[model samples]
Target: MPTHLWQKSSYSAEANACLYVSTPDDATIRLRESDQPDTILTTTPTTLHALIRSAKAGQLDHLSTA
Candidate 1:
């Protein structure tokens, strides 16, 4: 993967709660965390989009221990 292709989430820069992502191909969404960059979660754009929406809506709040 090209180094330039991976982008960190905005909050990653300001906090250790890092999230990184890449789109290696049109059909895939790749996710990583700074604490474990070698591991990745691959998904479809549609699913990722829905996840983002749910997260932003606080629907995922129950999963958080914070």
Candidate 2:
């Protein structure tokens, strides 16, 4: 099996927990947190785009109690 080179945004703090993303295949998107590397979430590009759009629009803010 080939290794996926996970990448995180340059804007994220180097010493803090960050979200890492990887593409194991053309149709798959993988996400994992720095603090919890064993847990991964997978989604498609379309779904990921929608998530970003919703996040940017603050639609998910209500779900967070913070």
Candidate 3:
């Protein structure tokens, strides 16, 4: 089996769901649920930054509720 290597978030709870992120040398950031690190989704830095900004602006909550 392949290794499920991922970095843990500082705010992660022991029994609750969390996320893990891996930034590769090629500048791609990969993300996955901490409980399922083997399955990953990759995104560019610019896209990730935009998503973070949108999240901070509360735009994501509207999208999530839609």
Local distance difference test scores for all models:
0.87, 0.89, 0.78
Error of 2 at 54 (Å): 0.5
- The digit string of per-residue lDDT tens for model 3 on 30-66 reads 8888677667888999998998999999887867745
Q: In candidate 1, what are the lDDT values of residues 13-58, reduced to their tens digit?
A: 7667599889888999899998888888999999999998999999
Instruction: Flag the better candidate by TM-score, 1 or 2.
Output: 2
Q: Score residue 30 of candidate 1 by CA lDDT.
A: 91
Candidate with the greatest TM-score versus the true structure:
2
- Candidate 2, residues 1-66: lDDT per residue as tens digits? 357889996766888688899998889999888999888898999999999999999999999977
Most lDDT-accurate candidate: 2
Please give the ranking of all candidate structures by TM-score, highest first, separated by commas.
Answer: 2, 1, 3
User: Which pairs in model 3 have colliding backbones?
Assistant: none
